[model samples]
Target: MLRVLAVDDEKPLLEELLYLLRSDDRVLSAEGACDATGALRRITRALESGPDGADAIDVVFLDIHMAGLTGLDVARLLAGFAHPPLVVFVTAHEGFAVQAFDLKAVDYVLKPVRPERLAEAVRRASDHLGRSAAQRPPGAAGPPGPPAVPLAGPARHRPAPDTGAAPAAGSAAAAAADRAQDLIAVELGGVTRFVAIADIAYVEAQGDYARLHTDAASHLVRIPLSTLEERWAPRGFVRIHRRHLVALRRIDELRIDAGTTSVRIGAAELQVSRRHARQLRDLLMRQATG
Candidate 1:
């Protein structure tokens, strides 16, 4: 059973999240907070007093925009902890979607939340916790360390295997790779459209849909930015703002103006949130130098 803590300033949205979470049998416990300060207090309390004095929080569902301290601020505070909960940013604003992922958040959920979307986010959190637990060193109480790098060694040479088996293995591997790279399909005007992963310049979250910007044109799809971010992030997509996820390779220019930084992709200019400016600049610099 996964332990979850949800924080949002909006009472209605908070209640909705609580209701959706409670319906899931996999959830062991759920706590809700209406503001950042209160949420932080609750989280600290949970850490201090574990479930049955054994288990602590496994995941946090956070809202990016809140009164006093924003969800991003809360995440930064938690980052200082030795064992921070896995964060999933839940917000109605798409502008922060990219910025959320840039924080290394496990997932993002957009409101008004759908049951299917909430279920997917919960599943991802559970999987992340399971993998983290499996990777921990013997007797370790918290998250695991960085992944180990395999040591260099001479190539393990072996005699050519049977032709039949070799071709079958290669075919299976290629098929799996293709499946992993399959494009996301979106329906518009009663016609289904597919956006190739490589062709997407960026995705911007509007009120209810995300706009897919490509070299040729733009298309609107009725899917939340949070869901798209979780699905495409692993495929070379990076969030630069709450509502924007840009393809790192498609970035034509990075500029600073009046103390604010922005990225130019194709013809569209997108701002880099203040919280994400430093990290995005650093990443761009590293790529340029590399």
Candidate 2:
């Protein structure tokens, strides 16, 4: 039985979420808020009043954009606390999905929520929370205590080995031979394009679609940034900003202007928000040294 909290500025959306959550047997309890501040207050109160005098919120469904104190800000605040609830962002705007994942959100669901999508998110959140609990250090106190979420170190990009020559007939296939044939197919508009992961220069979030930029051209695909990041982050696609996820190999240079940092890749420049600048700088320095 997961105790969940939902926050959204839209009254109708909040109501709908609450109704859906209440109907789910897996949800032991649920709460709603119309803004980040309200949500924070409710969470604080719940923590203070609980039997153990600490919040037991297992999951949170957060809306990225609100009148004030964006969901990302709320997540940041929660990150400071021990054992923050698993976050599953419910957003109409797609630009912030990458940032949500960068903050280690459990999942991201789009607006005009579909029952199946919400269900899938809940399932994923359950799995994540279970694994997280199992990994907790021995003798650690239960929920609402400050527990650190492990952070992955700086991003590193490495190009795949070239396999131009064909293997001889009837000979054993090389290990590289197996990888050369693997690629993800992306469909955009009415055309399907085969994109070898190595060819992608970057991926940008645009509303409900993602713009996949390669050395040759860019294509718009109907996929969430969170989905793509989960698949590609281990393959060297790094989130440098909220809206931008760049192939570390594609970064041409890093520049600072007016106390803000930016990364240049090919002809386009992407801004790095202050919160992420230090991590990005460390990644860049590591790349230079290596």
Candidate 3:
């Protein structure tokens, strides 16, 4: 079970986050902090009072746009904590995805949260915690340390590595590549594989996961469509409907039939939601010019 802290300056949003997290079967406790100060204080108190030095917070669902200190600011402070909780930024803005990922956030969820989407974030956080536990040395002296910082910015394409020589750890290029990976990891037949974002024709939401459609196959990943929309929008993926996101480059044709807007990507014809149709067309026009 996971113990979580929900932080947001807005009272209603904080309440919503808490409610949603608490409703999950995986969550043991869900608490809210109206600001960064309160969150830090709670974390300090929890750490100080926990039995045998265990962390009280397993994950933090934070809001990016806050009054006193933004979620990013809070995250930076968490970097200094001895046992920093997994941070999941729940924000309306999509532009912050790069920075959030750079900060090593477990996941970035969009505003007007969906139950399935929120649940997916929780799963990601759980996976993160499990990985952390597996990597930690047995009976370590102090609390588990903060997460490692992720490299900033999109990576430029580089040639494949040679089997004979391995690149040194923390190489600038390697870090950049890690940060800028256009590929998303997906589990296929009990094996992990990387699916290139460019090759993805479209993405469809599937409860707590997403179906990544490519030319030859589709892989179901434990990431929500909203999360992918925020992360990949800057990379030519655009939301065409509530349940679907299409890659601008893979969209071979757009159709408006009987006042209904739709797009074609590799024989898959997906209807664009009324609200997102105009935006999709505008994006298509922009792509046409660029």
CA-only RMSD, every prediction: 19.9, 19.1, 19.5
Count clashing residue pairs per candidate.
Answer: 8, 4, 1
lDDT of every predicted structure (CA atoms): 0.75, 0.74, 0.77
- For residues 212-258, what per-residue lDDT tens digits would candidate 2 score against the true structure? 88778887878888788878877778787778888776776566666
TM-score of 2: 0.48
Which residue runs does candidate 3 get wrong by more than 4 Å?
50-55, 144-290
Model 3 root-mean-square deviation: 19.5
Q: Write the per-residue lDDT of candidate 3 for residues 1-290, one digit (tens) a residue.
A: 89888988789988988888989999988989876656766666555554234556778899987643367877876766577778999999999999999999999999899999999999999988888777878865365443332111122468877777666776868877965586788887899888778778889999989998888998999888899999987887888888998777777556666778777776788988999987876665444322
Error of 2 at 207 (Å): 47
Superposition error at 280 for model 3 (Å) = 42
Off by over 4 Å in 1: 50-55, 142-290
Query: Which pairs of residues collide in model 3?
Result: 155-180
Q: Deviation in angstroms for 88 in model 2?
A: 0.7
Q: Report the C-alpha displacement of residue 250, candidate 2, in angstroms.
A: 47
True lDDT of residue 216, candidate 3: 92
Query: What TM-score would candidate 3 get against the native?
Result: 0.48
